[model samples]
Target: MRGIDLFLTLVVMLSLGAVLWPFLFYPLILRMLTTRPEQPGQGQPPSASLLFCAYNEAVAMPEKLANLAMLKRRHPQLQILAFDDGSSDDTAALIAAQGDLVTLVQGPGRSGKAHGMKRLAVRARGDVLIFTDANVLLDAEAIDNLLARYADPQVGGVLGSLHYLGEGKSATASVGSLYWRIEERLKDEESRTGNVLGADGSIFSIRRALYPDFPDSVLDDLTVSMAVIFAGKRLVKAKDVIARERLVAARGDEYRRKVRIAARAWHTHGHLRPQLRRMSAIDRFKYASRKIVRWFGGLFILTGVMAAFALALRIAPLLAMVGVTLALILLALGLRSKGGPVAAVVDILIAYAATLQGVFKAMSGRTVTVWNPAKSR
Candidate 1:
């Protein structure tokens, strides 16, 4: 019995370590080993399509159009197009109001963003397709910076840098911003070394010829980025091409977004698994460690909770109590702090919870659809 308990404890610790190492430790080591090079000046321009997918974004379309017009003035030759995903709002009218600065496509019904993107892809006339959200504001140089990476012929896709513009002193916004900073650092290092696992949907560019038509409900960026990688092409992260957006005001808003993202990830895992055998060993490890394990972190947390409970009843009650108490302390600290020590702790906990929620949701054969609006903080 003692040996069995020891083994179980060891297994739990190892599993937790496995999940944390890539997300937390790997970046630290990579940062120490490499530094991002200075971004070069704007190079030769490539004909590109700035694709925006909007869903009920009437309230924000006017601002988006203004930004697009600015981009057009700067890029001059760049083509811009947008799609309204069965929006009940006046989004279509707003796009129509933009005239030729933007082209508008209306979906037959409310299919997902992926469907809208596929529709847009068919009409895209540029050699490169840059996808961005309706609410995000791109800096004047963003499109230029993104296109410059194509100077490297081996680069198939480039990810835009995302910055969160949170309201005055919101803890949720603070934590989210900090999390993205960490993600950016990791991607920067990954790009320097030659591979990026995925791209954020807020902004990312891919070769039009390399574009893969994804299912309407799939996580579009992940699917498209991974497809580029698996095609023997390098997907690089462009730290200089920045896009800025306000963080969803409320923690609930972030949670709802994460749930949809996790659900789409689950679907992506099924479709991409078969291709695993064909990937290089390094890529296989990266996908498994960075993506697969992270998605299941919540299950590990639940298991740890169960194991702690069982151990408390069987033996080493003090150790189990201490562990639980420590976890609570971390959670409390995370809630109180900005993007500092507490935020890191809180992110780990959130990752665990989200992962666990996704697993149970999958096992119970429950499907998550319909967006739940998150409260603004």
Candidate 2:
């Protein structure tokens, strides 16, 4: 009985620790170890080529093109390139209408962003390749701010800050916004130390020459950004290179999006395993702490909860049962209401479950390659 108690206690603590360490302890440790400042880049901004892959984004095309035109006007040398992934809508037509303002690549079919990005990389003549999504809008000086970092020869890739809009509109959006804030903080600490783990596809740039070939099913932004580090260069995040995007307002849409992202992220990890093994010891620690631990966070959470229940049952079976039943009832009510603390908790659970599903799906030889913009976003 004592042995059982010890085992259960250890399992509960260890499992919970695995899940919480990334968010709580990792950043603290990172800050304590970080000694250097961000590379204050010098010299003129480099020429840039902006690239995005779109599919059935006709509604967003006009706004995106106008934003691009503004950026182009400010930097006359900035090259704008886009790929229409066989959209059934007027996406390609809108770009075609832009004429000289944009360079367009129309795919024969629904080739994924990885494929479109490869084509764009091949055609990109600028010194840097800036990758953004169709739905994400960049700030006016985002490009200039992104390129300004390139003045430091050590900086091979620059990740832009993504600020989510409409957090108060829905529980899903609020949860996402809070999560991204933590993520941005982690990225800041990582940048000060040595390298950021990787870039978000929403907005990030890499030296065109450093863009590496990756499998279509892999996460392109992660693969491309990590290649910068694999080549012995720094991948840093620039807070000033800002991009704004709306959060997925619907819980279901947000859940599916995370599932897809998590699945591709796992596959991308497998593809980059070789280079990952060769990274510096500290970087390896950061990767394992930030990425690997979080991938299994759902499983850890489950194990922890189960162990807690078992321990509670050992102490008082009747009270444990009553407590858990009440908790479940509360959770159900919260989920139905879809607002306030309870709803946010349920949303987080949904996110973790989705992440776990995606990880296991990838592990079982299934991978997500293509995705659509979240309609609610």
RMSD of each: 3.7, 1.2
Q: Per-residue alpha-carbon lDDT of model 2 for 193-307, expressed as tens digits?
A: 9899988889999998898987788999899999999999899988998998888899889889889999999999999999999999998999999999999999999999999
Candidate 1: stretches off by over 4 Å:
28-43, 167-169, 312-348, 359-377
lDDT scores of the candidates, listed in order: 0.76, 0.90
Write model 1 residue lDDT over 1-377, tens digit each, in one string. Answer: 98878977876787667667767777665556554343444457579998878877777778888888899999888888888877787888989887789888988877777777888989999999999988889999998788888877777888989988863445666667766787887788878866788887889989999998666656687888888888888888877898988776455566667766787777766767777678887667667766777777776667766865785757777877887898788888777766565765675577467656765565555534334224362
Model 2 misplacement above 4 A: 38-42
Top candidate by TM-score: 2
The stretch of ten residues in a row with the least summed lDDT in candidate 2 is 34-43
The number of the candidate with the highest lDDT is 2
